[model samples]
Target chain A: MTVTSLPHDAALSARHPGELGLRESATFDRATIADIQRAAATGVYDIRGWGAKRSVPHFDDLLFLGASMSRYPLEGYRERCDTDIVLGDRHASKPLHLQTPVTIAGMSFGALSANAKEALGRGASEVGTSTTTGDGGMTPEERGQSKHLVYQYLPSRYGMNPDDLRKADAIEIVLGQGAKPGGGGMLLGQKITERVAGMRTLPVGIDQRSASRHPDWTGPDDLEIKIGELREITDWKKPIYVKVGASRPYYDTALAVKSGADVIVVDGMQGGTAATQQVFIENVGIPTLAAIPQAVQALQELGVHRKVQLIVSGGIRTGADVAKAMALGADAVAIGTAALIALGDNDPRYAAEYAALGSAAGYYDDFQDGRDPAGISTQDPELSSRLDPVAGGRRIANYLRVLTMEAQTIARACGKSHLRNLEPEDLVALTIEAAAMARVPLAGTSWIPGAR
Target chain B: MVTLIGTETPAYVPAASGATATLVDLAESTVRDLNQALHEPHVQGEWTVTNSDGKHSIAVGIDAPVSVTIEGHVGYYAAGMHQKGDVIIRGNAGVGLAENIMSGTVHVTGDASQSAAATGHGGLVVIDGNAGARCGISMKGVDIVVGGSIGHMSAFMAQAGRLVVCGDAGDALGDSIYEARIYVKGTVASLGADCVEKPMGGEHLEELGQLLAAAGRTEQPSEFKRYGSARNLYHFHVDNSTAY
Candidate 1:
């Protein structure tokens, strides 16, 4: 075979049949080849952290339609375009009034370092938003640092307590996550420290599998009763949020609303997880941009559109993404992977450490294996101490502030005073797929691809 | 003598116990009011609740060290998250009875629905009759004793606990169980993922005997079989994980 060095992005030239030539097969890319080889060497499929890396129609495919001659735009500096949102105003006696549309998503104390969990709490608190407790339950540092906290009632029920339920500003009943919908969560033994083990009531070092479905209830009817039970337990004070993976968002949203959810959190395919099978992460669930339209349609059909708040998540990074999500009829948006990055995860400064672990800084996805050099996803005392919660918290808070400001800027450009006022009319899609998924008109055209 | 509280219903307060016995009737009092009364600070008493009539969430979230007795059938989550209390339900229990309980003793006189004593931390749950599917699911450091048969998926993902079943067990008996000892006396239909029947040793037999005695059972400990994790998939070993 003949070998030639070419630019990374340059296309391979076709050679005559007589000449010695080979072209990289489109069906077998480098990643697929490597995966095949790896699977050949080992019998098991890969398990990794983070979300889907495959190319899909995302928020980047959509663009905001700024004000024109027909419409007037608000001044960027002088205009007071509000970003405030009210969650769980439907049935909750005391609803959460957030100053920003961005809230921190759930990441467990066991999956993350205590410092990282505290940092999330501190950051969300600083930004007048809420941080959630994940699979292993609430930690003292998180509860103390967070101004508004949302306790996740997951199927695992790890370290769940009634006192903590009362302590929370809101309660989120997690039915499924986006990364691995209808699949259980996996926490490998290496990350299970004594504290984590104690909190979860497991052995010091053991693999823990969080159940896919809830233990008690099998269907939506039982869910309605469970919600009632929770309301009665909390004296109808704390807002109840129901979260679901973005598979069948239309039906899920309708059922969640029927089950008396104050807020419906829809997590899409691009959502991050601490650990899951790579197959599930890539193959399962719909995209965030696609999930929102169906969820809104469901809520509209049920005649409870804004009464029960909608929070969309998965691959949300910048202010533009936040604005787009809201324009698609979401009341709020949640950030998980981006929030961890703001807390200094995958920083290039730890390049050497990551390399030693057979991975690079940008390529570090071994959160389940637990020897995270970044200190955010590990349980090692020495490694965990590398992170200062206060400093990390400040960084996250600043990032959140920037995201909020950026979203406000976009809202003002659309001539909308409040973030919620930015409707679907203020947006356009760059591609046919995006236009169809987002239910928005094509750029420089009046037609939405899939609209009847 | 019966005393009225806030013109709602007549509550029977036993004078013999010197304000220690507070009898509540579910016919007149709501579960919310009863739970509110239980949550009151420094409220120490033996709460005798009558006419439950299959109501859900009876005596839920009781934190105090009080004794609660439900005279009739109760519905789902009958002592859920109960902390430091002695709760006795005289009749059948619905789904998720004593779920997420922390440091308490809950007794169900009749049969229990699915997921009995689920995710409980540091508690003792005794069911006199058969338990439905997913009993003791995700149990954490809780001791559960069932007098009769238990349905499928019992002890699933159980982190740390002892599930003592005096009678037969259904399919997928200990699927994905973690470190929790499942002792079953009667027939076992099947074992689940990563779960295997381990030989019953002296310590296990003695422990089973003690649990049986605590559960007020006459079954011999020698008749039981113990099951637990095979320790595969502990660290994501490629070849070992193929069985999953």
Candidate 2:
């Protein structure tokens, strides 16, 4: 086989079947050939796939108007767009006061390494937003690094303590996450090292199963009592948030309000997780676009729209996505996968290495195996060393600034001084799926079947 | 009986020995003042309370060896965290009665609500009328005797405790029962998971006699039937599916 290099701008010529070619029977599909080449190089098991393949509806089908209605547009750079968010206004003496509406969602310490969590916290702090701790108890490192911290109260009760509650700026009662709505978290046995096992109070080298229900309460009234207990423990200084996956959001939000929550976090389908069953991730809950309006409507019906802030999550990737979500009535947006991307999950510099593993850039979601070439997902000492926390945090901060800027630009173009002023009327859906799910009018039409 | 007029004084100030304190002045005190007075140390004496007016969490976290008598109804968590104290309510008590008690005596003349005597350790709780669901749940070392019917899932997950009920018990009476002695005088609605009726032996009768006496009941031990763990569902096994 003869090989020759091509010019920078040269076009390739078509070759005959017999010219510089082997037997046609020896040929293979591009994917199969790539797999064979990777196996020969790495000597690992057969190549397996990761992440979602089913085409779930997303925010791409929606569009935003730019100051065409009965409103005036703000100057691009001169006008101000406030992104402040206050959580837990119902009962907290000192609510969670954030400088920006954008915050980091919960990602467990066991799932991601300690350094990665710290980097996330630091980056969020640099951008004046809050960072949350996940199922693996509150670490002092995370608390000290973040300007504001939201501690998650999960079903597993891992690392839960009264001291941590007193120390946290806010407490989020996590009923469920969007990735696996009714399912519990399962840390595979291979990832359960001595430290991870010890932090979770489980036996080493065993798959840890988190219980679905809380040990203390059963229903809404009991939830009120539990909230009282937490308040008494914290001296009512911190705010309390109730987070639920987008399954029956109306009733869940109403119950949360009755249970005396100051904030509501509604996570929808397409949220990221360290590990979850593929079936649950795909089929459990509604899309984010469908969940936001329902939750906002619930709060509005209760006359507590701004009183109880609603933060939305799941599949948020761009600044345009953030603007679209706020227009639909989310007080703020939280990100996971995009944050990981900013921290170098699929950098093109590792293209050769990813190709060697039969994968490519932007397709590296196999985080549970501890072999991430980008150094963000792996627990291996050498691979993890490739990540510099300070540098990664700066990159994430830069990305966050860009997202915030883009959101503000859209808000200004919509004749809104604040991001919150980007109302639902500014949006129209391009597809029936989006139009029905988002409760908005279809493009080039005045029809909104669900509109009142 | 100490009278509290303002929040400056603790909610409950234990009386000195041989002193009788009338709680008539406590009628006008706020909940905050009452809590503060009750949390104060070194106030131990005989106390008589009148016109409780449905106050909740009264006499909570009291560890002194004092006797408190309430003339009217009480609200939730009454006598919670009582240690070495005796509290008597002439009227009904709300949920979580005698919650998390240790080495105390709580007597309710009227019915008690759900979770009565829940998670109490080393206490004697007596209810003159019926108790609600989850009665004596997660009890560690307490001895509870109810004169009327007890609700479902009573004595659930109890560890090292004794529950004696003179009237009928609701369904799943002893669900998830563990190492606890349950005595019932009337018909049971149904047995719970890992729970079954056990034959009353002489030693169990004696134990029942002691529990009944501690609960201030004059009933004979022979009138009651004993129940305990069936020991079938303690561990997971493939073939033992019938027990669970």
Complex DockQ per candidate: 0.61, 0.06
lDDT per residue as tens, model 1, A362-417: 88888898888889999998999999999999998999999999999999998989
Leading candidate by DockQ: 1
* Docking class for candidate 1: medium
What Cα-based lDDT does every candidate model obtain? 0.88, 0.77
State the lDDT of candidate 2 residue by residue for B120-218, as single tens digits.
666799999999998987666778999999999888766557999999999998776666789999999999887889999999999999988877788
Runs in model 1 with CA error above 4 Å? Answer: A1-22, B1-20, B198-206, B220-223, B238-242
lDDT of 2 at B199: 97
Q: Which parts of model 2 are misplaced by more than 4 Å?
A: A1-53, A69-71, A348-361, A369-385, B1-244
Who wins the lDDT comparison?
Answer: 1
Candidate 1 local lDDT, residue A240: 97
TM-score of each: 0.93, 0.68
DockQ of 1: 0.61
Residue B207 alpha-carbon offset, candidate 1, angstroms: 3.7
